[model samples]
Target: MDFIQQKDLSCFNTLGLKSWAKNYISLCNETDLKGVLGLLKSGAPYFILGGGSNVVLSEQIDQIVVHNQLKGINLVQESASEWLVEAAAGEIWHDFVVYCIQQGWYGLENLALIPGTVGAAPVQNIGAYGVELKDRLDSVLAYDPLTQTERVFNNGQCCFAYRDSLFKHEEGKGLIITAVRFRLPKQWTPVLSYPDLQQYESLQPGLTAQAILEAVCDIRRRKLPDPKVTGNAGSFFKNPVIPAQQYWPLKQQFPDLVAYEQPNDCYKLAAGWMIDQCGWKGRQLGNAGVHARQALVIINTGKACAADITAIAKAIANDVMNKFGVLLEPEPVFVGAGY
Candidate 1:
């Protein structure tokens, strides 16, 4: 465990935003968690951080920042067709995916290049190219702060809904994720379901997990700005899922309202398309603006405060709601006072 005071948090977050944590502690293993929790119990507010990819710290944090750095990976079981792999919370998400691919495991290739940690993956149910983390997750090991006990939750117990999971819900609040377990397939069955991925397949049909991973990484690199360079999260808002009836009227009006029908009577609409049509794709407001290539992402050109970014996000959401009658919800967790 490493502890520091008045830490400069610029390097901790992927966005490279200039921020400070009053106190910061990095836990290298679960054994260090008790002392960290004791610090948190001292009555100061605390924030649990993983890879710092999916978060925006608007202001200097006055509370303790517990940087989850637990790391390890083990193959618990392997059969003729399947393997169960377990990863500690602090493992880098993309690295873990690459490791699985190197070991001949499939299912996580489509999610390659996503920034964050294994623990945070389950919280957001991270997905890409028609592949979601829930599809491969076996269970999650989390520590209940209130109970002071470690509990394991299965897939069904996670209550995954689109990009949401139990960790995002009220009941699962105050629980810190310690580790994640995944079931990977030995036999390759590539998922080329998304439009872009399918198009890639048309060019080269028999895509392996490695091929899919490379393609997804290339696509993401071209589409989303690297947070290290641009100081931005991958996507600012989630694609709005509206009722089918509501979607039909908008589709009739625009004729190109990109939508996908869900299992229920709902329709998922592309947030980027809406923002782009509203003429906000490359629009800049001060240091904050929509990414020129991807409208769903908001970037900090330089020295943009969290409030400035949040203001732009609100403006985009308002315009989309006014024009399409759909509300855009933020994908990243907003921390600090101003959010």
Candidate 2:
């Protein structure tokens, strides 16, 4: 219920961009969540921030920033085939993944080590190692500020597809996610479809869920930079999925193009490889630079502003388009004005 004026959010976001909000509120529970109804009804502009992992904030935000701090974990149901678990929107996503593994519940191992909160998960439809949140999600509890009513969205209603869901579209806008319910399979299988995880099947005598979790965490740690040490928002762009008609011609042009076969005769071209080919990896434009180890990442070499990060990203996207004719889309949500 307590609101602070002109709050600095440099540390709140992983990118470490210097952003200031006219007002800020940290909602720790449902009681605190309802306390801001007056502000909502008063027609004040606002933004909901959770974990601040997948967002880009401008230097100055002309809105009230609500920080979701709600936290709890509960066992909702248990069946012969599945286990229904619910987690508060504000819980750290990585910790929740580890907790599920510890409880002997499986199915979310492939999604381990992803940054952000449970609320932000569905918004981005987070995925890794061939598994996505939609694969395990059952339902989501969200409060629609537009109507000031709560609704439960079933898996089908969520309309999940490649790093996206209903939460990103018009119908789900301004809706505050309260909690997420996951229907994890009791009978589990390790998802090692990705080339990196394929090696683990031979390395471990009997591949276990814990091993997969650890391996995923290790792979991410080795590949991506920790925002604590170097400011970053992880992968900067989504791999472009092109049709066969377009893929074959590009393949003929670039024999070394890194790509994988997708469903419906489509191909998912590796965005990192394309960026590297453009000679931007480990290169800096102003204070923003592409990570030397991972070309998909845009790092704030320290003291970089939103504009600096935006500059390098635009340069990289532009270069990729000119060379490959593929449009690269940024994965993270760019917030505020002048993005």
Q: Report the CA-based lDDT of candidate 2 relative to the real structure.
A: 0.90
| Candidate 2 TM-score, C-alpha based | 0.97
lDDT of each: 0.86, 0.90
lDDT of 2 by residue, 174-292 (tens): 77898999999887878888889986544475778998999998889999999999999989999999999999999999999999999999999999999999999999999889999
Candidate 1 segments whose C-alpha is farther than 4 A from its true place: 41-44, 201-203
Model 1 residue 321 lDDT score: 90
Return model 1's CA RMSD, one decimal: 1.6
Measured against the true structure, the TM-scores of the candidates, in listed sequence, are 0.96, 0.97
Task: Name the candidate that leads on lDDT.
Answer: 2
Q: Which stretches of candidate 2 lie over 4 Å from their true place?
A: 201-203
- Show the colliding residue pairs in model 1: none
